[model samples]
Every structure is written in C-alpha cells, then in structure tokens.
Target: MSTTPPPDISFEQDALGRLILIAPGGTRHVNVHPAKMFPLTEKDHWISIQSENSREILCVEDPQTLPEPSRSLLLGALARRDFVPIIQVIHRIVRMADGHQWHVTTDRGDTTFEVETDESIQNLGHGRLVIVDRRNTRYLIPSVPSLDRVSKRKLEHYY
Candidate 1:
C-alpha cells in the first residue's frame, strides 16, 4: 500500500492573471482573482470550495489520487510571488471522429479548441487515448474528434 499523505491545498495565480486553488488531488480550481477567499467545507464524500465572485462551488474527493505533475505545478505556483488563484473547469476525454480536438475552458468566458492529431480510424477499439483537463484531471475517450460535439454556450446564457 502507498504511504503518501493527502495532498496539501493552496491558492495561487496562473499566467493568465487569474486566481486558482490547488487541491490535494492535483486538480486545480482556476480563474480566481486576488483578494478572494474560497469558502471551504467538508462533506461526506468530498470537499468543496466556493468561488468568491460566484456561488458555484468546486468539489474534490480523495484528492491524493491526483497525478504528480499537477501537484508539482500547484506547489510551484504557491511558492512564487506573482502567482494568483483563479477557478477553472476542465474535462478531457477522447472523442471519436476524424481528428483530435483539444478544448480548454476558463472562468472568464473564453473557450478555445484546436486539432492536436489527425488520422484515419479503421477500428477505434484498439486506440487508447488520455484526455486531460486543467492540469491534473483526465479521462479516457475512444476517439479524438468527438470533443466538438460539446456546447460552448455558457450556463448563464440559458438561464
């Protein structure tokens, strides 16, 4: 069994001038502005923190399961003086189609996507792809081009 303790949580800034919270699981809550404090509370299966400007809360469960690079990045940001904390949400998964599409979302209402790889698929079952969001969050998708199906419209636009 592993002997590592739960990851430490900290708030810091990214290169985009947004405030972010580094959770124990290597998951980063980004787009946080300075002078903002996220309200933290522990629940049954997860820990949640709310954004200072909005009521939305990000939650993480068993944060120790996060990978190493994310943990290191968070630690580095906290140690740096210029870093700020911002909240962001990322979801990575392989989507099946003709090419690879990488999508990124931020709290500032900016969305970007680009083609990462291009190839023809004869059989998708043999392909294994890793999709990463933010920095630490990841998921497995069968194909790369399927990400385009996601709607880029904001939640507020519908409400």
Candidate 2:
C-alpha cells in the first residue's frame, strides 16, 4: 500500500501574533488557525488549517512530518487553541437557578464555573467525562473510576 506524503507546508507568526501558513511553491495564507480533526482522540494527527471565516486552507496528517520550525510552530498553535483543563478534585457543586455551579481544582489550578445543563456534561465512555461550562470552556475527567471517593460522590448525581 502506498502512503500519502505529508503536506509540504510551514507556519509563521506575524507581529500581531496571527498564525500564517506557508504552502508549497511560496503560496502564503495569512491569519490562519490550526484545528485538530480528532482533538479528543488522535490529537497530534489530522490537523486542519482554516482561514478567518473557518474555510479549510490545508489539512496536515501529522505535524511530526513537517520540517523544523514548521513542526514546532504548528504544534504551538494547536496548544494555544486546545486548552482543556483536567479536573482533579471537586470541592463543591451548588445548584443555581439556571444550572449548577461547580467548584473544582484542575491540573492548572482552582476554578469555579457554571454548567448550564446536564446535557453539557458529556460521557465519552470508559469512565471519561467532559464538562463544558457556560462559557464553552471544557474540563476533562480522564477517568471517573480514578477519582477520589469525595469527588466521585460529588459527580454521582450527574452520572
């Protein structure tokens, strides 16, 4: 079986901190963003670069295939775009008029956020859960079974 070669693309950050894509043959696409096709699963592979209006500019199968500065630049952009905090401890969950307010400590630090509804908490199976806050920020619970007793009890009502 013949494998498709990686896209011949590179990246550059402008003075304003916008991601610029340098395609093959010196074609440049300015102010682009790298979005992971499989962000929750195969994060490092299958990235799509999109324009300001979300138009697909190019698809990179693997950032590792790209040469030096390009690979680093692409990975850096992906890091800034995908920021899902891993919840380590659930301090408290208070019921609000609209939804529930969650106070938890994540891998990043302590934070409090509101969940608009039960539907916002998604179960990805195998004890993996994703809690999306009202602002659309996501917090990941990699393994429900691995959480402490107190934390598990706090989440029992949801699951």
Candidate 3:
C-alpha cells in the first residue's frame, strides 16, 4: 500500500497524545477513539473512530486501506484499547456467596479476579471463550482443549 495519506483524510496525534482525525473537508476531530465493530471475530476490519461524546466520526474498513501514519496510529490505538489478557492456566476457582474468584496465569502474568455470574463467561465457539471479571476486565481463553487436564476440569464445573 502507498505510504501517502489518502487524498483528503489523515490522522495524527495531538499534544496530549490523543488520536486526531483530519477529515476530508479540513475538519479536525480531537480525542477520537477507535473501536472494533466486530472485536472478537473481525478484529482488523470495520474499525469505528468515535468522538469524546461517543459519536461515530469515521468507519475504517481495513487499517491497511488507510494511508501511512494514519494506519500505524490506528492499529496502535486499537492494540492499547483491546487489552484483553489471554488466560494460560487456571490455578484455582473459589466459590463465594456473591461470585466466583478465579486464580489464573495469563500471558501477562498470574492474577485473581471475581466472576459475578456464569453469564460473565461467554463461549465464542471454536473452543474459544472470554471471561469477564467483576471489574469488567476481559480475559481470553484461546482454546479450551489446549488447556491442561486439571485446568479443563476446573473450568468444566462452570460450563
């Protein structure tokens, strides 16, 4: 793809390190955030850039379709935004009166979190799962079968 900025659209960073969008008609949108339309399935496609008020400013079909710095900036923004930790192993799960406390090892490191209900655990099919904790932090289990026998056994109780 060309490194040149698309004919009239461009993206840049502001002094405060926020993504700034320079629209086709020379309009500038500041503090614009990028959100994946289909975050789990089509991560690289259909990204929506929104304003501080959460209004859609632009829809990028593919980051690669964008020009130069804009593409790189958008991808970096998405990476920082979609910061889900991948759960590598389940160390323990303690049931409480209110919720279940999960102790696990993730790609980042080991941590414990509280899962309020079974609904917090979502099955994405293809052996994938996403567990949302009480704090609303999402942890990804890329493949259920890939887990160790003990980890799988611990998780079996939930699903």
- lDDT: which is higher, 1 or 3? 3
What are the models' TM-scores? 0.22, 0.90, 0.91
Candidate 2 C-alpha lDDT tens digits along 1-159: 112245666788899988898877778888898888877788778898898899887788878998878788888889889999999999999999999999999999999999999999999889989999999998999999999999999999776
User: What's the ranking of the predictions by TM-score, best on top?
Assistant: 3, 2, 1
Ranking, lDDT, top scorer first: 2, 3, 1
**TM-score between candidate 1 and the true structure:** 0.22
Badly placed stretches (over 4 Å) of model 3 are: 1-8
Best by TM-score: 3
Query: How many angstroms is residue 89 displaced in model 1 relative to the true structure, after the best TM-score fit?
Result: 43
The C-alpha RMSD of each candidate to the native structure, in angstroms, is: 15.6, 2.9, 3.7
Q: Which residue pairs of candidate 2 clash? A: none
Report the C-alpha lDDT of model 3 over 18-50, residue by residue, as the tens digit: 999887778999999988988889977888888
Candidate 3, residue 44: the lDDT equals: 78
* lDDT for residue 128 in candidate 2, whole number 0-100: 87
| Candidate 1: residue 156 Cα off by (Å) | 52
